[model samples]
Target: MTEHRPHSATTAMGNRHDYLPAAGRDALLPTYDLLTRTLGVPRVHQRLIDQADLRDDHKILEVGCGTGNLTIMARRSRPAAEVTGADPDPRALSRAERKAHGLPGIRFDRAYGQELPYGDGEFDRALSSLMLHHLDDDVKAPMAAEILRVLRPGGRLHLVDVGGPMTPADGPAARLTLRGHHVAGNLGDNIPRLLREAGFDCTEVATQRHRAMGRVTYYRATRPD
Candidate 1:
């Protein structure tokens, strides 16, 4: 299910960056939801939402929110919360916007995780699901720092991504896709290490066995008060 659908974008400073599409390919974009659902991402999304402990008036941000599945779910789970999902993929954002057309208190933005378009301390809570591993190694820390900057003091970040030591139960594809250089270093304790380097006090909260994603670890990273 791992697709290396790479795309390019230029920042205001004229720096070019690459990003992977939601489905790894433009042709697979339409079926992104189907693939995610088949992989039990919705269930993982709910767990992340539950951990977020959303409240009324909370400004929630989801980074790399492909197609808005988790955004829509958070909006539905906490109607009073204003939810925003940011991603670099326009086609995926379009689909997300359409899927959330009738939903109030929710919106999608065309932006990258590392270069969020929002103001400092603009959000009370942030969520990321299976999106961290999609980033390039060099982009990881900056994205973490960006998340820290956009969150109010004491705000919490709920994140889930591929991680941990590999096991025999993991399939070959999962091992191959997740063990890539860009991905391998981002796994396991390195996640917390990355967040901590960005000034967040992070702790591993839970872990799950993904059918095709190897071990998935959940972490709660808190911006200091």
Candidate 2:
């Protein structure tokens, strides 16, 4: 998640929507990076990038790039690839741009997931991490559709996020705090269903208990040629 500004920006489709701040509040935005890192987000990001299998000539997009931690990692991992990060929050985009400074073939854009400014079939792969849960259930489907629309034939969407209910394997504190009231019903099953409905062949690649996020899952969604 990224920090929100007082003003709103219109999407390419002329739709205006408010964005959730990085930490769910403007006051906590500064701690978003630290909190995500503590929750092992960096490791998950690396796994997502590896799953994307970036090629040197590939053009990739990172939705909800926030502070750009994952975006920077992907860019560095494949320096020859073109990396574009899209987020609605200007503050977060600023942080991302600064962090990604001097990195060739990488840029940050101020845009929302459901209304990306890019042309159709502009990207080879799209990456998202811990972003879907922040979206309202209704928005998730359209967001998936938009991602599918932006990806070229045979392109893939790499994602990792809260999947379903927590278990004893997750820390007791996490089980208590990560109840996920805002999480969609049957998230583990629903995400793939949404992607498939959006015309991608989707699969749950992995699942694990996180120290802070409860049960998390990884997905690989490919757009058919």
How many clashes (backbone N, Cα, C below 3 Å) per candidate?
A: 1, 1
Q: In model 2, how large is the Cα lDDT of residue 102?
A: 87
Clashing pairs in 1: 5-24
Write candidate 2's Cα lDDT for 140-168 as tens digits. 77788899999999999998888654455
Where does the lowest 10-residue lDDT sum fall in candidate 1? 1-10
The reply for model 1, stretches above 4 Å from the true place, is 1-17, 169-179
Please list the Cα RMSD from the true structure of every candidate, rounded to 1 decimal place: 5.4, 5.0
Cα deviation at 183, candidate 2, in Å, is 2.0
Q: Which candidate wins on TM-score?
A: 1
Question: For model 1, how does the per-residue alpha-carbon lDDT over 37-97 read when each residue is reduced to its tens digit?
Answer: 8888888899988888999889999999889999999999988999999887888999999
Q: What TM-score fits each model? A: 0.88, 0.88
Top lDDT hit: 1
Question: Which parts of model 2 have CA positions greater than 4 angstroms off?
Answer: 1-17, 164-174
